[model samples]
Target: MGTMTPAQRRALYESARFARETTYNGPLGPEYTPAGTRLRLWAPTAEQAAVNLYRKGHDSPCIGTLPLQRGPQGVWSIWLPGDQHGHYYTFTVTVDGVARETGDPYARAGGLNGLRSMIVDLARTAPAGWERDVRPVIPPARRSVWEVSVRDFSQDAASGVRPAWRGKFLAFTQTGTTLHGDGIHPTCLNYLKRLGVGYVQLMPIFDFGSVDEAKPLLRQYNWGYDPTNYNFPEGSYSTDPARGEVRVRECKEMIAALHAAGIGVIMDVVYNHMYRYENVLNNTVPDYFFRQNEDGSLSNGSGCGNEFASERPMARKYMIDSLLYWAQEYHIDGFRFDLMGLYDVDTMNAARAALDALPGGRDILMYGEPWQGGGSQLHRYEANKANLAMLNERIGIFCDDTRDAIKGGCFNAREPGYVEGKPGSFWDVGGAVAAWCRSDRLPPHAPSQIVSYVSAHDNFTLWDKLLCVRYERPEFTASDPVALAQNRLAAGICLTSFGLPFLQAGEEFARTKKGVGNSYHSSPALNRLDWARAGQYHALVDYYRGLLALRAAFPRLGTTDRHAPEALQFFSLEQPLVGWALPAAPGDGAWWRALCVFYNPTDTSRVVPLPAGQWKLLSNGTSSSLWRGESRTYERKALLMPYSATVFGAV
Candidate 1:
């Protein structure tokens, strides 16, 4: 291999961003080439560092070894001759006179079980037409993100995905896959298209430490919150964990397939913490990547062993560079931070600005959990819903107020919410419909900042939460109609509210975890998407789908302007009946001047007085088909059915 001049080395460093790195910010991991592979590592505190290459992914014996020279800014470097692609390598860093072997934290690909880093040929990982793969552009008002996990999408036999492809990256690429091979019932990518959601928020797909990739024979399942390597795709999700390039190729194929189906992808990232405190980051540079208390102990803000020290310049630079890599390489539509509140306001805004500078990233949808699991070491982290204003408008936050207000408290199972006939949650519900603008409660600057959702991966499913109501009321048992009505009511409140609507996978059909509150490590039977349930609860699925279509048709229903909530006027009616009207601009070939909606949670019927005009009924609680249903017009008062929500559009 020809010797790389100093200019070529600097060029390689510039690709990872920062040609002239300072401190710990510099080119990292192994970058492959046709002539040779350039390897670099940032072991600031280590006494010495070297690279060892193995023949196979799981091989223990080293095929060759090379000593790396220490350079400026604590960066270790080495230029290997010949094509070193596909070779499994690890860094041996000597710290305090003790030599330790560890994988690269910035590795874009990993070998089996993610124990070793693999040098990958980036061009070979691309699928056919990957260079020309297209992503759909969806406005925030029209965006509906459906949260899904890779394993849950097709692990069940009834999902109709081919045997080998099931629970793998290729599952998403299998078009025409159906339930029971009936062809009528769409599954996976087809089901996503039929649901009409703009984006799919894939739960943690990064290489994690929980599931053993080498032992796929066992029934090892997890939500994959334990991130071992932040850059590479989870090896277990790939067809073959032994070949690092296979995962890189197949993951892109999954993304390309979804993009072809007109669905954007949102990656669920867990950058707040690592799976273990003594990881690659700490192994190379001890006590630098994680936050430490005054006592010199690691902080547990993430409730995971340690929280990332994102406030540090080098740590923050790593995050931004990783994000840009995903955006440029995989064409990721958006990112959902697992515990966004843990990151300081400055880091988030800077990341947002960096993404915006790239094409199609200006209106990128970025949102996350507005709070953390535990307390942080930093005094003012902007890690909570109360600090929403400190973030950019494009940086969205999950509206826990609306989530708890729609259902009961996420933590408390028995606590009833507005739909469950709770007394005072009505005001919060009102605030949610306007995206909580100009309210005493937490109000993000714009409706775009609020992500309205009733149920997600963390809490109980909407259907089961309604089922929980049965334990308290007794009268509303499993057989009663109250549970179903409350389920629909919860959906209606969330879908019709202002802000982007997000739902969990199979939420339209009321996916349940067998009442398991936290199914992080539950059996596959409890977590897999039950196609039988989807068929059984077809009515609820249809109901949810119709609401999505209604929202899409009427863009005014999703106005992000703060004053849009101010224009909302509530009815004088008290408890049991919550009625409000918002101004709607003329569209859809129908001059809809105003839209009025009524929610009757009580067992008795309620009447809502409407303006003097012909009102076209869109949703009669059950069906909201734009053109098919009985379009009823009301002149005066509309009688809402017991335990149902009614909608009317003024002409």
Candidate 2:
């Protein structure tokens, strides 16, 4: 690399944007800090750039200023005094005229809606009293994930403290010690330990538009997808939103706590679009950041007001820098991309590279929801699929197969109940499973690339789905407690299945959101976790715990090796029931595990024959019935119970 013309530099930026290196968090190695305070920004078009610090309660508030020298490509940087750590600063770019963007590229804090950004001293207040002395250490590869929202996670009734930990950038960034905060309650962590989960996938915590902006009937529900600043965490979740200082510190504390507990935190990031109202895009070069439609309006590809113009080098750099800041500062374990399909393949590849170069580069996990193009329309994101295959070769995907299989075609659909001798809901999952089973098509990095789940935040509760298809017919409601047992059975399938098991915050005891399908806007009543339900669904919860322990005991269950489709046999002779088996490997001397998954959906007792070998029941709709197999099942009439799913094993 040598010094070149401005045109060549522009081309370099454009070309690098397409290269594999761009997919990663940029400058993965070594901190370039040479002095007390440093400033950096990823601005390409500016001829001159300077840092301006502004403080509260002042007429002429800009206290300190420093000019930045442009480095290679578009990076402009300057070093500051060590004492200037907690300052609020923003960048002023002068190309043809003065234009202010958000915050400094290397700004540790302060970016809230492009008004002002924070200058943080990680040394002074890092959790565990860390002195931020160590060099840059990137993140590690993400293994398992646990999705959680802070608002409904816990309640400190006595102290009158709620989940003060809103999704924030700082919560995932700090390192070297355990974070101390009420947010890291025993309930959430204990659940993580029980599930063998490694990562906590947090929803959006950026300083986004008010909740009122996302009301369902308002024809505008941003879901925090419309990012105002790449750096600021959402302030609404914090206790003191006006200052934003408490939010920053508390978030970092939360991250430190999770890290101390040996659990990783991953933020749900949105880079596809910016806010439609009161944004820098509307103030500055509007077309510079947004994708424009034929009528010169913002394109609505992300279902938000606009989509980012990743085709441009500057915009691409902004996203890369934002993500890198999160990884380096927050120490996040992984990222769950929402609607990643909207971004181009090359751009995503660049992002992957940037992340891959970090300290834990190779280990950092990156996953995404591969949705794309147009409002109310789904596009086949080749980028998303390619990224899934390419990334899973490194990371993994939130597999929709188990979810779709247990439910119907979509995540929101409910199961058609446990009908014997009939095709159950998600039968098509067999095809998806069969596809993954094909070794030739599997990603090369890991044996298991899919993160399987029976329920997620996007759909109705597993319990609600059960009641709809099992207990009620014409009108579906969860008030009837008759179908409660069926709900437990579904949870069993989630825990015992092959892929990673993700339990939505409160599904352990079968929580339902009334009849609301997409309740993103419902009151806390819709989202709150009912601790009492844990007791009611204790049997199911215990059953899940046993299954989790069983899976841990047997690595074979989690094995990614898939059986040959034809060799994978399904027996229909057992009428009113379905039997599937994977014969023992040719040379392997292990006892073959014959699976006879029987479902009696109706209220009738249907008799079915048992499989060969010393028959034992692996599970039979109840926790106590799990793990303990009945040895005497060598009988003629197998009594099938209503809304029951039984797994029989051949010893």
Candidate 3:
């Protein structure tokens, strides 16, 4: 090995200029065709490249080896004639005379733990009636998203999922599942419909490195944030990890079932950084995939060791291509990017445009965390909170401003937001309602770009966070009047406010993780959605349902542009007391001509003024109903409940 000349360095200028000069997006992984599978890889620096045929997915020796011919654009290709669908393969590339073996970065499916890439027809892996599967259409303003984990979704015995399918992708296919006590109440799929959420943002289902897909899963738990195989469904979520088809087919079955239930599935994808820096993408193109510091070390932007040099042409191509593959192959309704801020603005826009080009792509929701994990040199091309205006519309960014303003700062678990009774800044609350939450919170951009949520998989559940500051007990229960009231208040504020309403799985019933802030590796005891609590706190569940129904009735509540005077008008009131009104459809027969909401986070109740006409009270924080049976009418003023939200519809 010797130092490169300036001419050679100019030819391969920092890998970026060199990559920009070359174009090859035709195909990189194994091409499963009628004539067999043609394996191809891009390794410009490779001295030699070969395909090692393995007998099994794990702990298997190579049965045969086939040398790949160096082709144009540095792509090594080997054409295998005859059936090679079931065969497992790995690329052995010698970079700088040092041999490194790895799986396909573009593999649609993979063997156990993603140690080897599996060759198969992706279409054949789809469940029956997959082609006919129709993704439920949901307007950006009306999508109520619930973040859920595949394992925790049904791992509980109380979930009524059969033992065989308890934690697998097949659990979603189980309909009419019931809890332990009643043996009749809806639990899994039926429970989702009962909850009335349009989309369930599944925690990373792509093959990740944290959990062993081969071993019994009862001993292991993770949120699946560490991705090993970007395209394939997580093997642990499938009935069988050895057979790659099972994971693929079962994942399709889950998506199809969700569609049948009128619920769309949003995949949580970690594209910023993978579990390992020396992964397939790195093994094949060592210095091409990741960003590097001046010392030639990988950048730690993702806080997960290495970040994709996303600005590079080929790297960006792989990301966008993978996103399209999931949309086209698995029929994934939407995508929620993990650590999306690491993605360059151009790359995010490119992905948005590509997804939009699909048949029903407009209905598909696209959103992500617009804040990077740690350090980055990509501030020039950052797709972050400060630069929301620079990105394309329809690509939503998480509203942490509204999140902290309404509930409290996410980083400081013990801090109090408005609902937690800290008398928080109403400006941020107004901004949240505005979908911009406020200018200090963010620029008053398009409503579609704001994803307003209080709790997700990243931190503590809303219940746990509320408990951390209020209670001493570590029990994951939905008890205590003020705590329950506060929980309901948080939901009420987010639902009634602008942007896409999102909550964690079982947050309606105060799903707690025993006060554990980061339960990414916690036991199943803490993660599973306690169905018994749904029965215990049925009233709270009803309140959340009512709010969702009201939101559905007023779709623009989630989609209305911030500061849109025609849609929302603020009622002049005392400081820290936020009140707004939305004019309903013009008609006398309508249940109400206008919808008004007032939020009070104080210990003492206050008389909030109402409009001239007679108004029917819809919710008192605890009960969020649009109907007027339990509550009475008010003309001038209504007593705002203590630490609660009050809703009134003008008659």
Candidate 4:
């Protein structure tokens, strides 16, 4: 049959069910062949679209302007014979009868700051052994995520990374990098390897709009939540942002290096909104790419201006394609969606399904923030966390309940949690901990559905939160003893909890952001990971390492299944104190049969009742020790220190 007429395409584009169609939506950006360079764009509302080709730089005058033919499904296409790679191009489209120019949204590589799309040979972007790069196999429940930003990771002079490699993707590739202090301590990749974290969730590495790629000395800082291009890597993280190939190659090298160290890389993606509403997609297609109100104003659910219309056919296709592109081309192990709730459930599930279809995709991790910053016209049930029941079982959501309960309140830093020694806080903390560890409270179908953590890149660090608590409550001192104990207790609850555990980059070392909760735009001095803290608080690091070791030794703590009749039993649910026992699964190795965890958030000591058996102390508030004939017979009672957590094993 002949191609559909423009009128027919318009009808389909405006139809309510158009987004559900599975037909070929548009071209996958510019494709170069021996015959010619074929360009295709999705601009349904545009009266005309033309390719404005530049010789080399974006500022250079257009060498040629070729008009494209409007094809079926509102797609525009053109083919220029002998138009080879290495040239730059942008689309000049007539939207609402006014001409507007923009870079290709699907460009794999682009000019500095993503001002122009570059025609690149995709094969040249790959690093050596790129095809053989494989993600480490880490079960979701066993996953311990360490969140880091590429720039903040090694931005400080104390980072000990090579001068040139500091704050760059190559920093992860550097071997033997060490932090200088009382004694040399492993930093960067070495530190992560020694910490035994299975995954490193890097802050948005995509081509974000905030940083000026051309100037390395501008001291620009951003968390990369403002996405300008979804497919390409951030140029600022590369040694040379002027060359598109450098960013791509360096990012791949970083991922390969991380994988070599047995650590998977999870890319933090912001598909909820674009850097600007007047971006490429909107300029080329009017309001088709964004959710619109009845008055035609763009939706501000993302709070960054506009919310992407992921339910639309082309928008959904673009998101799914970008995720798969990252997974397949860049070898990204997983994706952490930013403001995932703004997108529709279908889009999230479709992306998950697409990732699972790829090689090693089953092991691919997927998780995101379940809530949006603002209200949208979209149904609340469409949000990821709101609709978690319908989402893919492999997908996970950040547990804000457990996070707030453990780290006081997110908005109010002074609010006390279990670790903060807040009275009656144990009720909420106990509920959240139980929901996290026992699969019954939140009732997740699979263990991977819950990502439990007290602190992340967004909120106040655990140390900072405790400091705020100390200030509000005179009883809670900010001394090293108090901070160290609370930090250890928080880590114990998180690492020993059931769901996939996630920790902020410097959390292990009690890293602080100087009480600045939102340090997204803060100076490097405030944001950079303090390596010295690792030495000053070496005991805290050891406590974290011990917790991870304990979790590794006892696999029952990470069980995905809901608790059985005898699998998990709570000793008491009283305020300021809570205790529970988790029995080892039948097939688990004989390290210990049952593990008992006790929490005493009160200033005074509390007596916790244990099950009828001889138990060995595996860990207490100050330090943790492996079981080596150190047995303590408890006649159904164990004394716990004030504001401390203890782990016991039934031997």
Question: Highest TM-score among the candidates is held by which one?
Answer: 3
Candidate 1 wrongly placed segments (more than 4 Å)? 1-26, 472-480, 585-591, 626-630
**Clash total of candidate 1:** 0
Q: After superposition, how far is residue 74 of candidate 4 from its true place, in Å?
A: 2.1
Candidate 3 on 21-120: residue-level lDDT in tens? 4557778788988678888888877889999998788788999999999988788899988878778999899976679989988887888898899888
Best of the candidates, lDDT: 3
TM-scores across all candidates?
Answer: 0.94, 0.75, 0.95, 0.92
lDDT of model 2 at position 136? 26
C-alpha lDDT (0 to 100) for residue 251 of candidate 4: 94
Ranking by TM-score: 3, 1, 4, 2
lDDT (C-alpha, whole model) for all candidates: 0.81, 0.53, 0.82, 0.79
Clashing pairs in 1: none
- Candidate 3 lands at a TM-score of 0.95
Candidate 2 structure lDDT = 0.53
lDDT of 4 at 60: 80
Q: What is the lDDT of residue 60 in candidate 1?
A: 69
Q: 536-609 in candidate 4: lDDT tens per residue?
A: 77777877877787787787666656453235677655676778887888886737788889887667777767
Better of 1 and 3 by TM-score: 3
Candidate 4 lDDT score relative to the true structure:
0.79
